[model samples]
Target: MQKLNLSQSLSQKLSPQQIQFIKLLQVPTAELDTRIEEELEINPALEEGKEEETEQSQDDDFEDSYDDDLGRDDHELNLDDYLDDEYSGYKMQGDGNYNSDDDDREIPISSQTSLHEQLITQLNFLKLDDRQKIIGQQLIGSIENDGYIRRDLEAIINDLAFSQNIETDIDELEEILRKIQTFDPAGIAARTLQECLIIQLERKEHPDDPVVKHALLIVQDCFEEFTKKHYSKIQKRLDLDEEGIKDAVNLITRLNPKPGGASDGLVRTQYIIPDFILTNNGGKLEVSLNSKNAPELRISRSYADMFDAYDKSDKKDKKLKDTVTFVKQKLDAAKWFIDAIKQRQNTLLRTMEAILNYQKEFFIDGDETNLRPMILKDIAERIDMDISTVSRVANSKSIQTEFGVYPLKYFFSEGIATDSGEDVSNREVKSVLQGMVDAEDKKRPLSDDKLVKMLNKLGYNIARRTVAKYREQLQIPVARLRKEL
Candidate 1:
């Protein structure tokens, strides 16, 4: 067991700049500003602006700016690499330094107050003693982003006693929670999805509306059955005929399952900034990366001047050289960052262009069926890059098309060969599966077995389990749950 063995194993490791380039490549348009700001804060030499020199003059100055030996030990460089146009350059845009027509600053903050803030505001109207108010505040705090207090009453009681030095029982906490539940957005302090739905239904209680009363009954008495969409069981249990049950079921379907999210289209949070934009001009497709992705960065002139002063100084004291070294190090870091950004832009453009060319038909017609079978390796081969490199670009990157915004992953689908000896995209199969479900008779919704037959008829030749997998991927519920009156 203690025997020594000599072995040689070759492993490739990414350099620091290469790693940086990969990270920067994957960052979406939304977070690019934050990343650039972080670099600016850390590297004094790096600043946000285009270089001031004219192209020809800058080329001439670049020669005399620094000799071969100058800054060689410091190592890193950028400006010349940027001008190299490394990765096949861009096609849709004039330069890889692409800019956006729309300003990100135009996006507005949420007009409606957040869920917890809204809950806290409602607590002001309640007439409570100090102890009661404190408990009420804790309960409100316990409420999650979805407006549900998922924590058990026992847990809250323990938390109050041990942490807040407030001796509170389960009963008192429940009273406060009940009061909080009565607040706006209808389902604020519910414990579960069932409870949230019941709260919304009870709030909309109407004496004359028979469907409303039946809906409440369905939620309270047959929650499990209602959730499974076992409409037949609910009808038999409640002794309701076809028409009556259908009306009641339809009303239940209309209830807000997620009351905390989009209450009558009055609340919203989060916005997605697309990384690229694709447009169809008659038949030709134009693709460009987001403007924020390509920032105009240049080394600070003042920092460069300081370095130059140090470089030419006759004072060769240890302290002077040390200061020069520090200046050179910072300058090198800034140059490295700038170079990484340029390479990131080049890689992104190359990757997007390859994907655009591969999925050209889909982008042109805005048709999912037109999307060919494409994978990371397929793109890697086309662009002559590593599969992992292509993957990094497609991972979080999104493109805005004339049709809509779509993630790069959306265009890359696995191949599924048909009985006719033709390979098609898995998306094509999913589309057929979705269409079948969408057009199925709700009274007797098609089961996975039935779906398999339909898909087989369409020349897919997929198994039932495969159909189930695709259905789950699409987030569509099973036959029993999908059943409707």
Candidate 2:
């Protein structure tokens, strides 16, 4: 049987304004202009530009009049809360305002043709029938950005039959593929890395050269051993001398691993617009938000005038009341949006300032080892904000320093204990590990165990697994794969 019971529970919920602030806070400087433009389009009451200076006494009088005119009647809506100036003390001196440096922030676009277009242009030069041209186009379409057509011939044959409804066989497709492979990039449309390298080598001017022949032979015959760097096995199997093999290896190493990377048309270049600009002035670090982040915004003056007109009108009909309600909503939305943008600017500055102070040593010297072990909680507590808020700021934001631009996430790292009982950033460990790898003998690369021992010798109390983890994170391959001739 069900019984009625009274239960009390407490819960916290974000108001509409607070939710709006959170969303605005996370938007990076790059996309902020677009977001603001969208708001301007939807809300007629909101506008873009500096808020003109008006008489404070007049604004106070307007607010007081609004409260008195719209009494506390159940039928009448109270708009006194929204009548006050939402932009008071909003403008920060020398911040979020127009300046001379605004011209430098514009990004120039490239008009170069893409990779696929160039390939298709070359395809036009081929003398083929309608069917052959279609197959050639199909093969070209299968080529990835790396310039390799990794799709299996059988699968492509099925795809053409099912999707294109064109009956084609493996032999006919392969013929067209070979013709396309003869394109300008030399290695374009190759099925495998070995084939890609061989295709490039075959196009060399001096095909009869001894080194070229050896390189082709090594790639075509002992590709697996060559990839594993088993130079001795390759020598024994090929019955070649050390100098001959080394020269051939050196020649193969110079070949382009990714032929498509050379083409300007296929790859879209991405430019990073940093959210903050940081500079080293004498010994002090200075950080400022990118000018684009600080847009000039204000409430439309005409919209404010509507409230004055509504206040003076003696007749309060149903239609007029509905119009006033609509005006109030638009005004409320405009005020909240402006307030959110202002709060976002303040929050971003606070979070970034705390980070700069916390990692002050690293920014000063541009040294990874100098970075301390910092987490979201550290910055959150310093700014009296939540950890999630700090994370939202760091996740999408970047700062341009005198040395270089870096994502805010780069400054945070876990701590590692040293023999001296001092806590150090794991970035320091990775830095040392990278140095060791770079200086290691090519013929005998250091294993994870060896790296762990070396690190421990330097007074770092780290385990073998942690060293392996760091090695992988650095994109360093295993000892076996790193072996070289």
Q: Deviation in angstroms for 442 in model 1?
A: 1.0
For candidate 1, what is the TM-score?
Answer: 0.82
List candidate 2 stretches off by more than 4 Å.
Answer: 1-16, 41-44, 54-110, 262-265, 280-282, 307-332
Q: What is candidate 2's TM-score against the reference?
A: 0.81
Among all windows of 10 consecutive residues in model 1, the one with the lowest summed lDDT is 67-76
lDDT of 1 by residue, 253-306 (tens): 776666567533346556889988787777878888789888998776555655
lDDT for 334 in candidate 1 is: 77
Candidate 2 lDDT (Cα, 0 to 1): 0.84
CA lDDT scores, all candidates in order: 0.77, 0.84
> What lDDT tens digits, residue by residue, belong to model 2 across residues 264-339?
4355657899989998878978999899988988776655666556664544566666666777787788878988
Model 1 stretches with alpha carbons more than 4 Å out: 1-12, 54-112, 205-208, 262-271, 279-283, 314-323
